[model samples]
Target: MDLNWYWYIGLGVLGGGVVGWVINAAVQKARKSSAEVLINKMREEASKEAEHIQREAKVTAKSEILKLREECEHELKERRREQQNVEKRLSQREEALERKNDSLDGKLKNLERQEKEIELLRERLNNRENELQQSISKQIDELERVAQLDRETARQMLLEKLKNEVKNESGLLVRDLLEEAKQKAEKESRRILTYAIQRYASDCTYERTTATIPLPNDEMKGRIIGREGRNIRALEAATGVNILIDDTPEAVVISCFDPVRKEVARQLMERLIGDGRIHPTRIEELAKKIAKEVEDDVYSAGESAVLETGIQGVSPQVIKLLGRLKFRYSFSQNVLQHSLETAYFMGIIAAELGLDEQKAKRIGLFHDIGKAVDHEVEGSHAQIGADILRKHNEAKDVIQAVAAHHGEVEPVSLYDVLINACDTLSASRPGARSETTELYLKRLEQLESIAHDFAGVESCFALQAGREVRVVVTPEKISEGEAQMLAKDICQRIEKEMNYPGQIKVTIIRETRSVEYAK
Candidate 1:
């Protein structure tokens, strides 16, 4: 019974084992099928997604193509438009060229015709000269036979007698006419000049361009110099002037090319020295205040000048510019005072000449107005003055006179000439101007030397205080055109070789004299 029980147990165990293996295999198979189905379903989904992706890509590519096509089409259109424009311009240029060619041809034809006409006229003149020569020869032969002398002797005797008589009469006539006219002109000019000078005698005032500030002590210079020179630098930066604090004991020197800056710095220095508190901020503040004060004083000065001159209806801008001349100097002579003197002289001379006195005075007052802004403006004072006058709506005559005062423009009226004379008179007066004699003589010599460099120049004079240079040229050597060219060359040389203050007038005088003595 134990054996049979063992056998059955063994078989049961084996059967159970087989059954478990089969179950496990079936489970594995079932799982594998489910996994395959899942994988297939995933593949289908993936395929669908890929198709969707492909569709999106195609759509994107098509849109991109459309954009690119539009862009290309726009670019092509632009190119076509540009080509059309270029062609149009080229055609227009061609037409213009054709028109120019036609005009040139017409001009050429006209010139040819004129040349032919000139040739014909020349031929006719030659023929007429031949006929006249024949007639003269026949008359001469007849005269010789009648006089019973050779042609040479008879002609010489007659010519000598006629020359003697004509020479004496012509010389006397020319001498008398020239002497009378010269005397009258001299007398009138002297009278006018004397009357004008007598009527308007002005006080001579000269200005020195020195800006030396006297400090109380040398210790004060250290304060002005500040820590590491910030004080001096601030003063320089504020006033646009150099504050030179060298070994100058108890004195500070200010240097600048601009007079306005020098004056401003001078006032600032005085105030700072009085205040005894020197700092950068204080410097800037004081500089501004002093600048404003100076400006006001300048304007007042201009107003005072205008009132003194009795000028009416003056433009505020012009008056302001005129006031700036208070600090300006020409050859150490105060420009403002010089202008006042010039105005007075102009008025007096105008009265004597029976001219408009107010107008004359107006021109004189504004003649040097350009000097006020010349530092800030380009061009000569005369041209700048004219432009300023034009901007101010000044009278055309007055503007012309101001421009011509320095011969920058041709004189259009008597005022222009009068301004020159009065300007010279004012400047040339004794003690009116103080120039370095050595430097003045050197400049004049240099100017003359510059003119002498040009060929055909007989002599050159620096007149009008070196404002004008008169060059006398040999008429035989320099023609009229060459004289003008020589003047220009000399002027160019002067401009290149030397530094001058004002515009120099180069007058080229070319004259010939035919002189004879009657015996």
Candidate 2:
């Protein structure tokens, strides 16, 4: 039992020793681990601080670099500005120097030219003085020898001679100029008139105020005369025409001073005869229908003329008036035909004169349009036509041409002059106008009597169908100047006393016959 107790005690002691050693070692290990943890923590803190310091240094250095760069840029910019200012000043100074140099050069050139001019003047003055002295001495000697007169007398004689010569020469020059101008004017007038006449081929026809309507049978005349002349009276009243149902076989005669009325009457008679109607009502109805038809025909005629002449923008009223000319007659010449001839003449002349040909044709067409209503209107045809054109908003030039075509107003354009000439030409052509034998003979006799009435007129002959009168004057009675005056006087007298279609030319001939026997 004792051995077992001792063994138990030893085991206990040994166990206690082991436990203490383990507890010590465990404590040592814990201490070592905590120490290592502290050192590692300190190392991590040092690394964080070093990194933060490095970042601050970098920020500070970057700020310093940015500030230095800005300063350097500022200095560089200032230096560049200074350099630019230096360059600008230098350029300005250079330009100023150039301007001063140019001014000096100009002044020097002026001085040089002035000096040269003064030198030349001095030399020329000296030469001229010597020449004047020589010339004066020579002129005195020569004048005394040649003229045998004093200086004053020679001067007066020379002045008188020059004055006489100038006077004679100037008179001759004036006379020659006047003659040339007169000849040129005459030639141009003749050329323009002749050229217009030559270019246009006018188909002239005699227009009659009376129209004869053919009847289908003798019964038609009675129908036209109608029940106690009621039909004839109705037509005459409705159309303002005189319907004469004479004993003529199968025909009716319609007469009126107004051609439009006559035309309407003629058409009415034809329709009534064709329809075999003999009542006044039918006569009136047909008259109205024919009148409207005549109006349409008139418009058609006017339009045809406008188109043929290539004229545009004519008012409807003016065109209607132009159409009335279709049936009108002027001294046996168809007025429309006369107008066409005048228009063509105007176009030809206007083209030659480099004017607007279409405008000229328009003026010609409207020139005689007033004649259509002249019998009804109070004013002259030219003035009335001008008023019509003005009302229609025609151009100023066209209106003036219309007003001045007949010399009622002063011509304002070449077109107006051409229209007047064309009008005269159309009226004056051969076979253009017809006059009775009695009237024609009377006109010729009147022309001759007027020429004979003038003093110094020995014999007068009418030529060119009374267009010209040649008066032979005695040379002893009338001088050349008197002959011209006598011609003008006769022309004026004829114009005032006579009513003629065309101008009459008065020519006075004076002959001084020097008859000597040839040995």
Candidate 3:
């Protein structure tokens, strides 16, 4: 039993020991596992702290690098600005130097020109000095050789000698030249005038003042007188002509101051007498019809005149105006006939003189065209005719010729002078125009009055039927030259103022004879 108890206790104690050991081992293992877990957690915390520090350092480095790059860029910009400023300063210095160089070049050019001028002035001064020295030397030599004459005496002697020589030679030369010129002029003038006159032998017809009209019967006059002379009165009033219906068998006398009006009245009376309707109303109507017919006749006559003259391209209006010259008269000469004759003569002379025959014929034909309407128009017929020709677009030379035919305008062409010469020859031909008794006496009075107007004339006489005018001049008051001039002046004045058919030969009789006979 005892052995069993001991054994049981030993067994129990050993079991207890084993249990304590197992319990101790389990507690120790648990402590070790908890310690290991704490260590691993601390290691992980340390590694995390190191990683965070590394990240902070890397960020700081990147920040520092960026700051350094920025600072470098700022430095580079500053360096570039300094380089630009240096370049600008250098450019300014270069410009200043260039300006200085240009100024120096201008100054050098001026200096060079001044030097050349100084050299030229020096040369000129030297030349002038040499000329003055030579002149002075010559003057000294002259003074030493001869004595000076008085200025007035020397000049007077020279003048007297020159004057004597000039007077002798010049007087003879002038006299010879004057005599030769006079002879030549006389010969040439005679030739020209003779040729002009010989070439143009125009027919001159005397203008008759009386117009004749044949009546139908003697009883027609009683009808013309009408019941109370109303027909005659109407005829006179319409035509400005007096009806002379007495002592005539088969004719009626028409008298008027105007020849045109007289012819119109004469024609009107004839028409009324032939119609046998001699009343005041019929007279007025016939008068108007006859007036128109006469006007038409005048136009036709003018056209015929122009056609006869071989002048074409004349306007109808100009022809009508020219026809009016048929009834017009100048110095007892029919103006239209005279113009035609003058045109014929002018054409002949123009052919002889180697001129334009058509132009000459036209100018001569229209020369007196204005005379037809001169009473109604102003100015001379030549000037008026020129206006008409110009309006018709005539040649410039023709217009000039027409205007200068009467010497009223300055002759611009040779044709103008030729026209005047031809006109003069046609009018001044012998027996061309007749002078009336009243006109003859008036011309004689005019001659006497013109002669009296002269300074040396004592008396004047118009002889040869006013063809010659003799002026008796006082010998004591007039010299030969003065007498010649007086005669020319009288002739010119008579030509200008008087309407004569032929030229008047002016004779100045200056008598200086003394009647002292020794027996």
Q: Which prediction has more favorable lDDT, 1 or 2?
A: 1
Which ten contiguous residues of candidate 2 have the minimum total lDDT? 167-176
Candidate 3 lDDT over 286-369, as tens digits, reads 778888988889889989998787788888999988888888877777888778867877787677668999888888888998
Per-residue lDDT of candidate 1, residues 410-454 (tens digit)? 787899999988898898887887778899999999999888888
lDDT (Cα atoms) of all candidates against the true structure: 0.88, 0.85, 0.81
Candidate 2 shows a clash count of 0
Best-matching candidate per lDDT: 1
Best by TM-score: 2
Error (Å) of candidate 3 at residue 225 is 3.0
Write one digit per residue (lDDT tens) for candidate 2, span 1-519: 689999999999999999999999999999999999999999999999999999999999999999999999999999999999999999999999999999999999999999999999999999999999999999899979997888888799899878756655665565467579989988987897777777786665555555888888887777667678787787788899777778888877777778788888777776776677668787777778888989999999998998888888888898898999998887888888888888888898888788999888988888888888887888998998888888889889989998998777878778888888789889878789888989988999999999999778899999987889999999887766566667767988897788788688788888999998988
Candidate that beats the other on TM-score, 1 or 3, i.e. the better one = 3
Off by over 4 Å in 2: 1-179, 189-191, 212-223, 245-253, 274-276, 512-519
